[model samples]
Target: MNSSQLKPLLSIGNKLIGFILFVICAFAIYNKVLQNENLNQYGADLKIQLSKIHWGAWVLMGCLMVLNYTIEAIKWKSVIAETNQFNIFQALRAVLVGQAFSFFTPARSGDYVGRTLFLAPGTKLKGITQMAWASYAQLLMTICFGSLALFWNLPFLPWLKWVAPWGAAFAVGLFFYNQNFKGWLSKLNILQIGTGLKWKLIALAFSRYLVYLLQYNWAAAMLSIPVTGLDLSIAIMALLFFLSMIPAISLTDLVIRGQLFLLLMAPFYHNDILLIALTTLIWMVNFLIPSILGAILLLGFRLKR
Candidate 1:
C-alpha cells in the first residue's frame, strides 16, 4: 500500500488495539473482584474481619499510590527534560498510560511505547532510548537494596558475606561505566544530561521504592498482621526482591503473588486469608487500578500518526 493509504490503516489498527487492551484490563479486574466475594469457605469470615477495618486506611493507601507514581513521573520528566517539553502532569499521564500497556506485555517492555507517545513524533524514537537510562537507575536501586536484604537473610552462611564485596565491585563498575557512557553519548550527541543528574534520579527512584514499602506496611498494620519493625521490613523487601525475580503478567499474577506473600509472611503471621487480603489490596491499588486508568487514557491518544 502507498504510505498515504497505509497511514489510515495504521491509525485504525492503533485504535482497535487500544480498545482491546481496555477491554482486557476491565474484564480481568471485574473477574478478580467477583472472585473476592465468593472466595472460599472462609469468605464470610474474611469479609467480617475486613469490614471491621476503617475506610480511612484504604483512602490513605490510594493516596500513596498516586504519590508513588508521581515520583516515577518526576524521574521520567527529568531524564527527558533536555529533549521533550513535557511538564510533570504530562509525565504522569505517560506513566499511567505506560502502566496500561505494561499490564499484559512480557517483562513490561510495552511501557517504553506508552511513555514515548508523549514525546513529539520527531523525538519519540530518541525518547525510548533515553528513557532506558531512568529505568536502569531504578533497577540498580532494587539490586543494591535487595542484595543487602539478601545478605541479612542469609547470615547463617558466613561465605555468603562474599556478596558484599561483589556488590561493592558492581557499584564501582557502575560508576566508571556511567562516566564513560556519559562522555560517549555526549560525543555522539545522543543525550546531554549530566552524571550528577543521573544519580539524583536514582535517589528519586529509591524514594518511590520506599513509598512502596510503606504502603505494604500500612496494609499489614491495618489487618493487624502481628509483624512489625525490622522483621516486617526485612520480609517485605525479601518478598519484593524474590518476586521481581519471577516473570508474570499483571493480569495473571494474583495466584502466584499471593503464594509468595504467604511464604514470606508465614514465619510471622499464619492467618492465610488475611495475608491474601493484603496481597489483593496491594495488587489492586498498585497495579490493576492504575492500569485501568491508563487504558481509559488511551482513548485520548491521537489516532493519526
Candidate 2:
C-alpha cells in the first residue's frame, strides 16, 4: 500500500488498540472496585478510618510511592542505557505505561509491551530482551528475602522447611543465569552494555523492594490491623512473594490478592473487615491510581515509524 493508504490503516489500528486497552482497564476497575462486595463494605469502614488518619501518614506514603516508582524507572533507564538512554522523565513514563497495562494482563505481561513502545523500532526487540533481565533481577530480590519469611513459618508448617531452601537456591541460580545470559543478549547486536550490571540491577531491585515493603507495613498499621515488628514483616514479605510468584488474569488478580492478604493476615488478626480494608486501601494507592494516569496517557499512544 502507498503511504497515503497505509497511514489511515495505521491510525485505525492504533485507535483500536487504545480502545481495547481502555475496555480491559475499565473491566478491571468494575470487577475489582465497583462490583467488589468486600471493597464496597470496606469503603464504608474506610470512611471512619479516614477520619482518624493522621493525613501526614498519607503524605509520607505518597512520597514513598514516588520513590518506589522512580527507583524502578531508573533501573529501566540503566538497563536500556547501552541501546537507548532515556531521561528520568521518559523512563518514568515507560514504567507507568507498563503499570497501566499490567492492570489488565496476567503476571503483568503488558509491562513489556508498554515499555517497549518507547524504544526505537530497531531497538524495541532488544529492549524487551533486556527487560527480561531487569525483571529477573527484581524477582530474585523477592525470592531471596521472601525465603526467610517462609523459613520462619517452618515451625508451624514443616513442609516449608523442605521447600524454602530449594526455592532460595533456584532463585539464586536464576540470578546468576540471568547474568550469563547477558552474553547471549550481546550476541544479538542489541546489547552493547555494561560491567557488573547484574549486581547493580540486584541492588537497585532490592532498594525498590525495601521501599514498598516498608510502605505495606505502614499501610497495615494505619488501618489498625494489630500486628507489628517481625510478625508484620513476615506477613508483608509473604504477601509480596505470593503476589509476585503467582499469575492471575486481569481484574480477577485483585480478588486473588485480597484473598491472599486475608489468609496471610488472619493468623495474627481477628478483624477480617479491617484487614480487607487495609488491603483494598493499599491496592488503590499503589496500582489503581497510577493505572488511571496511564490510561489517560494511552489515549494519545501511537507507534513510532
Q: How does each model score on lDDT?
A: 0.74, 0.76
List residue ranges in candidate 1 displaced over 4 A.
Answer: 1-49, 154-172, 179-193, 303-305
- Residue 235 in candidate 2, Cα distance off native in Å: 0.9
lDDT of 1: 0.74
How high is the lDDT of residue 33 in model 1?
49
- Point out where model 2 deviates above 4 Å: 1-32, 154-157, 178-195
Instruction: Tell me the RMSD of model 2 versus the true structure.
Output: 3.4
lDDT of 1 by residue, 115-174 (tens): 887787688877886787777777666666666766655434456446654864686466
Best by TM-score: 2
lDDT (10s digit) by residue, model 2, range 1-305: 89999988988997677667666765665565576655565677767776687889889878888898899999999999887879998898888888887877777898898889889889988898889888888888787777778766422556765686688788777566534334547565444344488788889999988887888788877776668767877877777777787887535666777777777766777776677667776777788887777766666666677
